[model samples]
Target: MAQDEVEVLVVGAGQAGLAMSEHLGARGVPHLVLERDRIAERWRTGRWDSLVTNGPAWHDRFPGLEFADVDPDGFASREQVADYFAAYAEKIDAPIRCGVDVQRVQKNVGRPGFRVETSDGTIDARYVVAATGPFQKPAIPPVVPGNAKVVQLHSSSYGNPEQLPEGAVLVVGAGSSGVQIADELQRSGRQVYLSVGPHDRPPRRYRGRDFCWWLGVLNKWDEAAPPRGAEHVTIAVTGARGGHTVDFRALAADGITLVGMTSWFEDGRLHFASDLPVNIANGDATYLRMLDEADDYVARNGLDLPEEPEARVFGPDPECVVDPLRELDLATAGVTSIVWATGFVSDYGWLQVDAFDADGKPRHTRGVSSEPGIYFLGLPWQSRRGSSFIWGVWHDAAYVAEHIAIQRSYLAYDRAIRSSGPHLTADTSRHNQDDEPTVTTTGGSAVQVERAAGAQLGER
Candidate 1:
């Protein structure tokens, strides 16, 4: 087995990992980025063909990099997003090793670093940055009967309407992906059934501005993560049809059947809970809440912004609210395809450390893990509502880089004073023999760490 060593190892070459690599490079940090496939592989292979970005081009991009030839309000396609990241990787000259599958990562035995096992070889890293992004494994629930005869596909594998067989398509899960796929299928002349779920309703544009801009100025993007075990909300907005707010009433009127949460599948019949009305109500509540926040923000500053009264229709749809479908006979309805757009889950089985909570949530202060020498980046709500967004990832990577730099500087200083361990290249001018070392985080700002005085090498 080949053995290598590095100061830092970043796992995943998606937006998150590339951002980490770029920041580390800018700091002159000795690091290497490992990816199981090519850069931005998930965007190229894991997403549907017809999918577009959730945010518009201007707001959903890395800082200082514009999506050229794309309208600022327009949404980039899946291909465009993948290419954009690839181009960013190139522009930053990121040091990446692709096609390397990381098998496991554990503390180095009797050492001060981690042993990262990969298909290529073992790479000993002083610190490991798990920048795999939010999506790891497709979370598809088992709702199909054992004997059902339907072409089932998770949203990760779903391509376009033409790929499915000639029959009705039932899209379960009303998150952005599911809703967008259902809308696409229905517009392609296929009978579509959308299983609505509890989701946050966000308009594509609100008050002559993109919804992201409103969220940014309103500080919604800076919203902190909820307490552990608290329920979270999934955004149900879409960027399809250039960019538009999702109106369930309009979708119902457009001939797509709106169903409730799927309960069970038995006797070739799919049963649904009567929570359709409640879900619609909850979504409407969020919609109204967003509008009210925006309106108040505008009024508070006396800022001039147009009000689209047409966007404020809060009435429930008759088909979905009054007479929601409870049960559907798959055979009778001629439904042949099922697209499960359920959410994704992180697979940390390869990570052998105590950096996670009982619920498998990463235990981190921002991106800095409780366990030293370990960090996480690009997790949804890891630090804020925008942690997983492209620009958010860049900022998060910078924070993590600062943490790593400060830690490395302290270690180097201690080693130079004590004359122990291998030589490190980290600058240690901040850790002279004068002040005590301590670290604290000021939310949404640059990292703040006290100078080190007598801290030993390898002290976290």
Candidate 2:
């Protein structure tokens, strides 16, 4: 019913969105941040109650605000993370509109702007940024059979062991979420069965320091890259022990039954692969490779580091290695619940733009979208390996803000020139090559989007 126009319209008020808002605010850019729920709603509603950050508080700092004042050494709980975001929003005075669901975002057919359809009203924006982050939908496997007698929950919906039925629980996809949930269930005195898969289980702490500390010292953040083939890795941070690693070997030692990938469930029997030991061996081998890399880095840099105890290779027990179960009778095992922790996929169906690739991932060079006036933030490997992390989004946001400012400046200059006699062209002699608005994406090329953006936006 109402038309609100802005220079920038940012969708989603999570870490990425708020970080973008902070940068925009600092540059005196007029932008509105829209959120379907409260800020950091995912942390509030999606994660389990016992969930803590894989990294410590020091890594959670935004640009201006630092978590050092709160809990620099401790991992932040979900509530703490949500509160930190809220506090950051307040401190930055971010222009965030919560409870505003954006139904669609498309090019304005009547004008040269983007028409953002929200639950509250329509917004005509010169630029639209989708900062929804990576987790839009939970990725549950279609192989999960529907059974009326059993309860099933995705990792996003799982709260705690007490919420589940009084029986064994099958945790699928042994990534960070799966391992953590399985560990919790087992420790809570419930029989837990974990489905093992190809995963990177880096130790949370090594050499008398947190693994993240080493990562930071080696500038690993700058060299960050997800291991090829895996969507994401699970760091396996232990809850009560703080920075302890939660590897499969440790879990097995704690009496948790580890199985191979679950193939199917039919007639009260759950089928699994017999390559459970192979999976365990593969994980151990990967861990060793990472450990070696860290050692190599320390040696090459000649950085004085505390000596870790002789690293011991961990593998499954002889019995497990010799004989792996291919199936589990749910009724006999008393398994009444299953939790799927298969991660999530991005969904940008509401955005009517040719900014996505065949895989449904946004096609952006850095954070700038290929589609004019559309950008993306908080995507993994968007600019750097750290692009998706809380501490990483600020750098990308800064670049995006500067690009937008340059575009706006160009627009204003163009508008002023048009207001004068049409025969005179704007002076371009004062500008230098470096002053031109350009951004470098992962593609290793510079893209300039400012030359005629002003005149183009003027028609909106």
Candidate 3:
């Protein structure tokens, strides 16, 4: 196996990885980006053909790149997003090696830095940036005990209503994806059943502005954090007929049946949790809370924003609501398919290090890992609410790059000083050297540290 060394090794060539690469390049840092597949692999293969981002093109940007020749207010389709990243990678001439699967990433205790074992070879990197993103793996629950007669599909594999089996469809987990799929299936004239769960809801438009636009104006992305374990709010907007907010009330009016959380599948029947009405109420409350926040923000800013639309309170129709049925015989209900849109999980099985928290998530402070020389990017609320989004990753990338640059300078300086003599011990005395060297960069940033001409280098 070939052994290659680099100053930095960024895993994943999606928006996050590409952003990191651009920042590192601007700082004159020598780094390589490794992608297991083509750029934006998930966007290319995981999304439904009709899907468009909940946010508009204007908000979709990576570091040093913005969506061009696209409708600023309109959502970018899955293809458009994939193409944008690909173009950005090409435009920046990012040093990306795609089609290389990383087998494992472990600290190089024998020396310093990390040893990245890939299918192709090994990458010995001084700094390793895990830009593989938060949505690396889909979160499908363990199989609901049922006969193999029932068809199951995750949101990632779901394409359209036509792809589903003929009959009523039980769309599980009423987040944005589940609801959207249910809506589409019903619009296609199929019987759709939605299983509700705890979720945040924000109106698509409030006070004559896109919800996201208001979020930007109010600096929502800059929020220190979301509630721990909180999932991203499902922006209840759809891509059909251009784009529009999906009203569950309207869906109920249009014959879509809402049910409670799916607890299990047994005896050839699907069982639902008995908290249907409560979940619906909670979700609606969340929606109002968001609206209240927006209203408060406008008032605090002293902006003469247009008056909010007549506030019609949202609630589940009593007729459509029910004490969760203990079980529904799929055959009797004519439900033939199930679409699970529970969420995604971060899987770092290939990472052989103790960088994760008790929740199995990488423990990092604003992208700086607790473990030195390692970094995380593209995580929801990693630095702020927008960290997971394309528009938000640049900030985190810039900070990570700066840290890496500083660490590099310190290491180089230490190496030089070590080679000087026995007079300078590797203690606090090393800091007193007046003739310490500095790293000069084209980006106008300078890092200073003590230096000796021919000292042995220490791993950063």
Q: Pick the candidate with the highest lDDT.
A: 1
Roughly what TM-score does model 1 have, to 2 decimal places? 0.90
Residue-pair clashes per candidate: 0, 0, 3
Per-residue lDDT tens digits for candidate 1, residues 1-460, read 3999999999999999998998888777889999999999999989888788989998889985799767988999888998998889989998899999999999987889999999999999999999997789887788895458898888999988989999999999888988899999999999999999888888888889888998899988898975343355567889988888888888888878999999899889999999988888888888888888999999999988987887876655675568888999998999999999888888888889989999898999988999899999999877788886888888889989988877776665455556744443332446555534343211112223343454432243
Which lDDT tens digits does candidate 2 get at residues 1-460? 3889998999999999998999888777889999999999998998999998777777756757776344677888888889889998999899999999999999978667798899999989999999998889898887756754778889999999999989999999887778888988999999988988777666677766676776676576776556677655454445444756766766877878888888987788889988788777777776677678778887898878776745655554745445777898888989999999888899999998889999988888888988888999888877776775788888888888877776665555455466763322333455565454443322223344454544322222
How would you order the candidates by TM-score, starting with the best?
1, 2, 3
C-alpha displacement of 1 in model 2, angstroms? Answer: 6.9
User: Which segments of candidate 3 are over 4 A away from where they belong?
Assistant: 228-240, 300-304, 311-318, 322-326, 419-444, 447-460
For candidate 2, the C-alpha RMSD (Å) to the true structure equals 5.2
Give the higher-TM-score candidate: 1 or 2: 1
User: Any idea what lDDT model 3 has?
Assistant: 0.78
Name the best candidate (by TM-score).
Answer: 1
Q: lDDT for every model?
A: 0.84, 0.78, 0.78
